[model samples]
Target: MTASHGNEIMVVSGASTGIGAATARELAARGFHVLAGVRRERDGDAIRGDGVEPVILDLTRPEHVRALADRIASDPRHRPLRALVNNAAISVNAPAEVLPLDEWRRLFDVNLFGHIAITQALLPFLHRSHGRIVNISSVGGKIAMATYGAYAGAKFALEAVSDSLRRELAPHGVQVVVVEPGAVRSEMAGRGAATANDLAAMMNPEQRRRYGGLIEAVVAHSLAFTRNGLPSARAGAVIADAATVRRPRTRYTVGRDAALLTRLARFLPDRVLDRIAAANLRPYLPRQGT
Candidate 1:
């Protein structure tokens, strides 16, 4: 279905890369006036295009979210935002047993709380336009992995919040939908692998001996899956569809592995799943230090 907006404006957070960047492109191609909200000016400049407007939007800053809301609320040309895509997120891989509290907070700050803040600030403008909210969650939200403790926790929280918001906004003619993707190809995946490698390197001798192997395995497995995963652009199209469909679904599960992973997660017992995950991730453990 075609997007409901005819020259309507869309604000997309985390548009610098991955699904956000691709979504921005897709929306612009579809005739929506797109605002590509990014944290860095360089990232923004790299993304500016024929129909895309790049804006500095760091989700962690309350003022940024508020200012953006105000802009949409007051702009005579585009007072009401037609859609808001809460796609900004950070992925940190570490076992919960060793994961730092600050790491968890940092993950939630951008992934869960930040999105909530931006959404709340923009609700008035969205309400005026009868707009939609598209949340870019992950397969981790629905399924627990071996080493993505904090990232998965944030995504899981986002899923819960999105569900509540969807129910609350339905009466106002607003739609909220969740997009869960599995192993999409993106630079973020590579960064996550690299981060894991660094973390493993930083561990003390005992710590490294106790958990380093498992951590490295997680990183390696992630790199392998990402190398073989669906393209980020494919996932972006699903997100764009979520934003514009007349009767958008409550959730859209994309990528070849999404269905399989979600089904396995749902049916397999927790202990059984854990065993499977351990086995799958074990092979990637860093080989003995060179």
Candidate 2:
């Protein structure tokens, strides 16, 4: 264990890659001691260096979450945890009707429930330090679209939870902030595409016939969105700001698309938004006969 310098410590989950990894590096660069939570030994090794301590954590597993809390609590060299970044999440893309209940539950397990569990376990440390909790949500949290039902639903719930948590923890001086990012370069899009493909492959002929083209379109759009999206580092910077700012906003919207779309969602009618979304998917829609 590294000796404590009395610098505030921050816990960033899903630090193995993407925004989480970027945030770990950014925070460490800013002179904060970062406990980067990864799921695998290899990932821990990958993130080792530059004031970043890699901790193996699997959010889906309660034991791992508990162990993390216990380890932090018992470590003599650590300062009280000053920030918690709930960045770990999984994405599943499918039409609402065909999407399995199990997959939806699994998404929530990692993105919502696991996050809540970690927050609860570490509240004592956060309270003691008068710290911050940064929840990584999405533009999907504010706007729901077809084929993204599962991911959007989870994000939506996360936003709600963050709101409640922020109000509840304010009296204790523990700030809860939501970072809503639009499409950004990250492993999530690739992983989501892979999962969608796997699910498509498992579909029966009838199922494929009914939904295959739409799924393919959604997956393709997702891939393109990530490819052209803002860098993860930008989002990481925003998250780091949310953690360290003297007076942070209730929510930080990252990326131009995220800001624009979220704003449009607030003023635009659903019927108009629906038409725009449908038009975007029109090119990929299956032919009338085929």
Candidate 3:
């Protein structure tokens, strides 16, 4: 760790990779002792350098969340937890018509409910320290896309929850901010691609003849763009800034693309945006064949 204020400490969930890992590294570099929460021990070990204490915290597990809360609450440093960054989330893409209910539920289990569990668990510590909470929502949270129904649904729900939490926590001297990243160079893209592939495989031959190829193609193209998007370090900087700012706003849209896309989505009419998306995704349609 570099050197932070003696009283500053931070916790970041989903610290295994991508934006979460970058945020942990950046915070540690700033001299804050960071509790980097990860689901797997190997991931924890991998990110253990630079004063980051890797903690096994799967947000889906209430026991782990409670343990984390207990540790923070009992810390002698007495230094308030400077921030709690909820960055652990899963993105799934499937045809809404045929998407499995279990898949939808799983998305919410990690992306929405997990965040809530961790937040509720850590509330008392935050109350004591007057710390900040940063939820890593997405641009999808604002606008729903065709094949990403499940992921979009969870993100939208999370946005509402975060907004309400911000208002409710404000009076208690705790700051809550929602970060909506558009696309970032992260593993999430590959995972989304896998989900798309799985969905394509599940379609019947006639269904594949109709829409399966198109779905895969669109998801692949989107993933390509996402894989080449902004670096995670950039988003990490925004998260770090949100943590230390004396008066942080309720939302931070990280990266140039994220900022631009959000502006376009907001200013453009719903129909216009829909048409634009449709045009871009049209090329994936299958040609007549056996």
Give the number of the best model, judged by lDDT. Answer: 2
For model 3, the superposed segments whose C-alpha errors exceed 4 Å read 1-3, 283-290
Residue lDDT tens for model 2, 1-290: 12233377889999999999999988898888898999999999999988799998888888998998997798777677888999999899987777789999999899899999999999999999898999999999988878888889889999999999999999989999999999899999999999999999888899898889999888888888889998999999999898888888999999999999999899999999999888878876666785
RMSD to native for every prediction? 1.9, 2.8, 2.2
Ranking by TM-score: 2, 1, 3
| Superposed model 1: Cα runs more than 4 Å off | 1-6, 286-290
lDDT of 3 by residue, 1-290 (tens): 12466566799999999999999998888888899998888998899996688999988888899889888877787766778899999878877877788888888999999999988888887888788899998888887778878888898899999989988998998888989987789888887788788888898888777767668667767876787788999888888887777777788997776787778888999999899777767776556577
- Using alpha carbons, what is the TM-score of model 1? 0.94
lDDT of each: 0.85, 0.89, 0.84
lDDT of 1: 0.85
**For model 2, what is the C-alpha lDDT against the true structure?**
0.89
Residue 9, candidate 2: Cα error in Å is 0.6
lDDT of model 1, residue 47: 95
State the lDDT of candidate 1 residue by residue for 47-163, as single tens digits.
999778888898999888877877776667753578999998877898776777887898899999999999988887788879999999999998878778788889989999999
Candidate 3 TM-score to native: 0.93
Compute the lDDT of residue 34 as modeled in candidate 3: 91
